[model samples]
Target chain A: MSWARPLVLGRLVRLAWLLPLAAVGLFTLISLAPIDPVQAYVGDRTALVGSDQRAAIAAAWGLDRPATERFGAWLGGVAQGDLGRSITYDAPVSEVIARRVPASLALIGTAFVTSFVVGTGLGIAAATARGGVGDRILRSLAVVLSASPGFWIAILLIAVFAIALGWLPSCCAAPPGLTLAEVGIGDRLRHLVLPVATLSVVGTAPLILHTRQRLVVFLDGPAAQHLRAHGLTERRIAFGAGLRHAVGPALNLHLAGAGELFGGSVLAETVFAWPGLGQATARAATGADAPLLMGIGLSTLLLVFCGNLAADIAARIADPRLRHPRP
Target chain B: MTLRARDVGLSFAHPGTHPDHAPTRALEGISFDVAPGEVLGIAGSSGAGKSLIAAALAGILPPAALLDGGITLNGTPPSPRDIALAPQRLDALDPLATLGRQIRRLGGRRTDPAALLARVGLTARVARAYPHSLSGGMARRALLATALAGGAAWVVVDEPTVGLDPEAADRVMALLRALAEEGRGLVVISHDLPRLARIATRVLVLQDGRAVETAPAAAFAGDGTGLATAFARRLWQAQIEDPAC
Candidate 1:
């Protein structure tokens, strides 16, 4: 029973090489683009410039060297925790990302937890009431939500909740002069309502459907019958037995979906004017700020990698069949 | 403790468009008693509800099947914890869990499983193996160990030696006899007349969900006057009559 070896080793090897390769490739392509950084800063590509000025600018940014030499310097800087300074922001790329990363991480983390809890609970309820009105209604809701595009759903929610109802501010406001710890739970929840709800509602459908399908299949298995025959309480059997068996596939999907949430949050931040990585990326992309763009891309890659890694570990923990193989 | 089923009947609801879709009776007016420390062997042809009786004694009848009469163990209805049943199919064991864990789950103790497995002629090494890693006989023995692990007052073993070599069957029957001598009631359900005679003290004959005869194990040994002989004679006559034995 030693199945975990090949799986862990294969994933580790891919992560060690493929991720660095992807990051290097992205850095190269963005650096070699035909756009001029000075013109991008000046907002006029045809603006006349002296050769000495261009040479000084190229030397200052280390772009005067060959592409290989430049990439090597950049890679070495990355290895030394320097990530280089953003030409547009005039600050360290790491510092800019560090300040905004927490906000985006908080938003996506809350959304992931909210979606997982609500979706799995609804799925179990629907499964227990299968072929009944509850199941039908749940199925209809899941299908509708799953088919609706996330951007459209986010717009619809904003229009109804923010514009029509006027319950909360439509965009980011001042933090109300409260420390992060001093912010009342209710007040924080009120502020987070739109973003968290939007993210969770858009992400919940697949999780709900997967959980319901897996639970129904598990209920039909021999282990379920064995538990029933053991005189375990129905509630215990449903949650303890049913959920334990169903958690593996549900978790894998949920974790994969959690990684996609970062991408969704980028769009969502742009739409809602939320101060997060997506907004920062949009600002950088609009200005063709290569350093800032690279920083955001690398940050997003890290988030996605961490999400998937957590998911793999959770799946292994949930499924003994995966952790141990027959000898 | 004694187990008694008084005129027990089980019927299944038939699904159809017809208005008069009465329930199909699987067992009808079946009455029998398994005394303490005695082995009662039930013999019947296929579809005679022999296994249903085992299920009833274990209090695990299917949801669709309705019980008509009472089934009492030790003068009370049987509870899941009090009775153990070994199903005919070895696939009932979970393929994912180790054999030791499955047995421990049933008994809720570690010591009993190893002892029970040893009693059923299984080695200590086999206890750690999965069901797929076991041979057919070893799987059956593991299943029996699981049944006996709970110190069940009565064990309803359904076709314990159905697909085993003669040596394995002897080992299983010897284990059952030993359990019976320890003052636990044993109900052995099988179609093998001679094997049942070897382990069973009393034999009960079932036909079409009805008990036709009850006699001592020796009654079927000499003359064909006992239930086993009568069951075989009925089968032979039915084959001669319909050619579908």
Candidate 2:
């Protein structure tokens, strides 16, 4: 099939509709909240401020305008490369987030790869050893971990490794370095250990469950038995024959969970004090920094959409069954 | 080489049963043999252990299946060099790969795919097609090609003619007959008796997991003249009763 035309059309349509609608959604959420943007910006008690002062602060922040006008202005400003000003930082929201994207991606990227490899490997092992003790153990562990919250795991890691064992740092992504470059790779990696562990633990569950379930269906079927009869080893039959079938579903489950993984990431980042977008978003929410919150929301949404696209491309590339057009 | 399964017994735990439940025997006292250059057809109704015997011979019995005896080729269990099975399910071929790569996976790095395809009555164009793209006959040929590439002494084919038209079935059986002519033993499992009678040197009748009777292919003729057992005669009688078979 010729995909070029549909691809261009899809890109144009999504850009035309999704960006504005998403912005409106975020703006509506922030505006409808009971908290005052003036009090949020001031970060102080309302009892200490005079009526004249509140009016001035509200006017300066455009909180005095109609909802439609404020959304239009915010969208226009964003289109012009201004993501509005951060009430908490007194800096442009984009600039604050720009400094944090690399850290968030690095943390998420490492955890993503680690969780994918370990979870998929364990799932394959469990599937091949179906009805065995190892399969039961891995399955039970995944069930328990899938239900466990990421923040709770983050706290447990800190209690055990950071505080109890005194083996690792508890926070701040590298001891509050003047610049990330100033911190040695060793220090960066050390700080990465806890956050990555927390994220990977939470991320691994869905992957394991999906892979195990999908793989068992494939491996226990006639195809696998046929492969065995042809002198293929169990590993060859499992990985070569079985993994090829298992990968598409597992990739879907993993990528589908990418959004939720990042959603839970904020808690891990906050508990560990990791200087990532998740922690930044958490702070933005608490401080009522609408601009920062909007910036993170759009960025996370974009990441999730991209993840979905990756899953689509991967499904086509990995399975010839999908590459052909269905009638 | 001679592939033989002697007094083979297999049992499976009844479905939805606890560990304490008695295992139901799916195959019992099943005995058969196929010599090189011979075509042996095992015939039975559905759930009659024909597939179970094939599974046992293929060394693919599941964990739940208990076996009392074993299969051997030339008095030893078939080695990687001894046998391969062409399964009924087309999915036996990896969907992710072209048919050529799978044949090569068995035949090794330097093997020419065109030659393998040619050996199985497939065109070189088929080498590039994925498993799902191939027609039923094409999928059956691909399985046959895989088995041939393994250089095994025997090939066990399960229900090769199940979904094929008459022309396609004849094409598949012709291919099997040719493989036997090349001195490779064949064990074919199917209920298509009339067709099996054409090529099989001997046929084994399985009922309730037991081999009730074994007879020469001639026994499957109109009235089952050479059939020794009443069960075998009834099976042959049913086919005789239905001309469509």
Candidate 3:
């Protein structure tokens, strides 16, 4: 606990640098894209807007300025808590993110929690059943699931559950005409099923494999042998000492996989047309919306940093030696 | 009644090989006896199958291992409650658990963890400490305390003095001697014969995977004339004559 302050400060310090790095990197990549911001803004009416009006639009959004100057000004604005405005949404970047945050959180959080709990349980079961038919079956299933792509899985689920049986909706977080408050819990959840299942299955595979691997090695390890020799039953040894040793690494692997989880979310969101940050990211990337994309990129970086920090804290809690090391 | 091993043999199926492959005989015709209030030392060079014998006695051998012969106490195979094995490595203690928790895990509902730690010469605070905070000697004593927690009649300790300084090694030897004096059967295994001789009531010498000699601890004293087997004599000679020893 005394280590908490320093750990938080250390992570914050890293974030201070990483935010700018991501912004600059995204800015450079956006600038390089073969896209005209004006063309994207005018959309289907590009020919009708005329060059003079196009020049006016570019000037209005500061796209006429040099990339370095724009980046410097954006960085300055970010330092003062302004994330600039989204050219695509015609709103502040922060406001746009705020509007979408809940939808994204709902989907991502549900998927993440589902994967974690189910995967951990499966891992413990497979490890305890080591070398048996159950172990082989679970391991084989995990390997196959891990090898499959998240988008493909999402598409397949949509095909069977949504298209053929017509048991669920195939696209969007809500029906096409619905607004945020108009959607019922059942409606939201019904819409959530396929995307959540896809993310959970993909996320769960690595955890099952990692947890099983660590626990198997632990159960066969010296500490466990010592416990086994001391009259503790196999059941106690596997769940007690074996689980204690395996959990820290499993939590670590799962949490540090935030990037992969987010990456999978993008794919999951795109396939299901879920209105989350992943969909926003796809929109921003496609339109080459510099400010909006920069805002999303910074948010993703912050999310990853937070995940890693949580991982460090979790590891310290799980293993006391990390929290209080003896010289 | 005594703990007895009559012609105990062990062979491991050569790993990752065809079923028809010949098994490797790691230990053959190993035999010994220890009664309550006795310290029987098993000694040999490194890889002398001393640990294999310990594993077999503790019934913790891997599935690939095939054991032949009986290890019984009072004319019956000892239950896990009747015997415990303390492995050689310090890593044998659960790194994540406090010493007290691990001790209580094995001690069951009837035994007190603090009392067990006290018996092993560790303070109550040591029980609260994790394994990583412990020194080499302290970890060894903690392992001893954990073994004692189960209230077993017999304790098999492997290389208790392997990584200790002479002072610490002496203290551990005294602890083992104390356990024996409390009427517990002790099977102490080590490569360090001279140190083991101080507390061992009888010594069983092994070479390559076979027992070379079994003699009273007194036979290891003086100039080795009392040792019956030539191999035991040379072992004693090597320990006494080597300056680095």
Candidate 4:
């Protein structure tokens, strides 16, 4: 080929099914949930409402239609950028998400960056130093944290920082005060501290493990052995060839783990009462707001799809072997 | 400068020795010398110490191995500046780099990828390709380029023709001959005795990690009668007896 093909186009084509498949799965599971959004919307008046009134409400909401029809209609509305109105917020689902996007962006973005930097750094250090005390400690810590659930860590942090020490608020994104822009950096940072930490503490473990594993393969493998025989210092060969070879696999694992990280955002956001899609998702579920729940589910699935695409593109950029479609 | 191994012996930790970790000898009574312009071939069967000796000469023996006798490149201990080893594996090529980029990196101050590829019997077009895209012969030559990148005076090539076709193997052997002609000491470890004999000035026979016989390449002649030891002769006899095997 005289001109190099756009690998991203090929990657996207390969990955195009991820979003639709995940949407179907999410819609199916949500539909199967035993939530009575109509009954929840009616509240205490369920006792007083006549059967005809109830039937009218159900039919109006298209709940009287077959599940396949309802899902199809909802999916069609989603394609038109209408995520339906929230029964709980008494507003458009998009508006509720819009009001909360900044909080999610600020929190998840910080978590995403912090987890990668710290995790990869620790992993490199541990691998290079192999049997050192630091590696031993970090490896054990990674094992424990990888298995630890997100909410458990959040609750633990709350117990220590908020209850026992009384140093920070137990919940909520910020103290009841002026808007976020008006709040000083110190106040904003304090509000950010717990949730970001909660996500990071649990999130960084898999990255560290994956990076270390890849580094070991690169450093200890036959290729490394061959490099050493070429009269270069161990440190130079390791930093040069080792890092270059390890980056592709390590980044792949990191990206794969990143998709699932959104799940943790839900627990982290709820624990701190941060007004993100995470917390909104929980509240929607609790209120049995089917439309709002579906909207949040779709958004989270889209984020995962984007993350996977980003990783594939990133891999292509970093390594030429991944650039072209495999023959 | 001559590369010499004087009664070189290596041992490794063995719990069989008792409560105290005593080393068990893996290689013993190994000795040889290769001068500039000489191609010294080492031959051995499976589980013999051929690759280990290659690694030791390049100062890359496993950490558990302990050395008794010294190895000297130009009367100093073996170091990367004077010695290089091209191992069997080609996957060691950095997958992230283009052939030219990797060649340049390995070449250090000798940074002309086009020149290096030409020297290794490859065209400049080969430089633009990734390691995986290169054919088996091209990859081997590229690795040879990497091994010679630092311009080491002595090169140890372990199983350089392991997976090559006859034509590619001939090309690699010819390249080794050309390098030897350039006055660099070369050591080749291989099971292919006929190929080694075609280029090697002298061949060192090894069995069970010990030097069995040191013979001029011409001595591996008809019926193996010219060989110095029965073990070396028997090995040749086996190959001659069962050429299909």
Candidate with top TM-score is: 3
Q: Candidate 3 lDDT, tens digit per residue, B15-97?
A: 88998999999998988999999999998888889999888888889998999988988899988788888889999999899
TM-score of chain B as predicted in candidate 2? 0.93
TM-score for candidate 4, please give it: 0.90
Better of 1 and 3 by lDDT: 3
| After superposition, candidate 2 runs with Cα above 4 Å error | A1-12, A45-48, B13-23, B226-230, B240-244
Q: Write the per-residue lDDT of candidate 4 for residues A1-327, one digit (tens) a residue.
A: 311356456656756786678667876776788877777667799789888988888887778898788778877888898988887888999999889888998888888888888888888877887878988998998999888888888889899998899887766666776677777778888888889888887668877887788888878888777777776666876688777666666676567666567778888998888878889888888777778887787677667767876776667767777666576
User: Chain B TM-score, candidate 1?
Assistant: 0.90
Residue-level lDDT for A24 in candidate 4: 77
**lDDT tens per residue, model 2, A109-156:** 898888988889888888988889999999999999989988788889
Least lDDT summed over 10 consecutive residues: which range in candidate 1 chain A?
Answer: A169-178
DockQ class, candidate 3: medium
> After superposing candidate 1, which stretches have Cα over 4 Å from the reference?
A1-7, A24-90, A173-189, A282-295, B43-48, B74-77, B89-142, B145-151, B162-166, B191-194, B203-245
User: Residue A120 lDDT in model 1?
Assistant: 85
* Per-candidate TM-score, chain A: 0.84, 0.93, 0.94, 0.86
- Candidate maximizing lDDT: 3
Candidate 3 lDDT, tens digit per residue, A11-61?
899888887777778999999999887887789986689889989988999
Q: Please report, as a residue range, the 10-residue window in candidate 1 chain B with the lowest summed lDDT.
A: B236-245
RMSD (Cα, Å) for all candidates, in order, is 5.2, 2.7, 2.0, 3.2
Q: What is the DockQ of each candidate?
A: 0.29, 0.65, 0.80, 0.66
Q: Which residue pairs collide in model 2, if any?
A: none
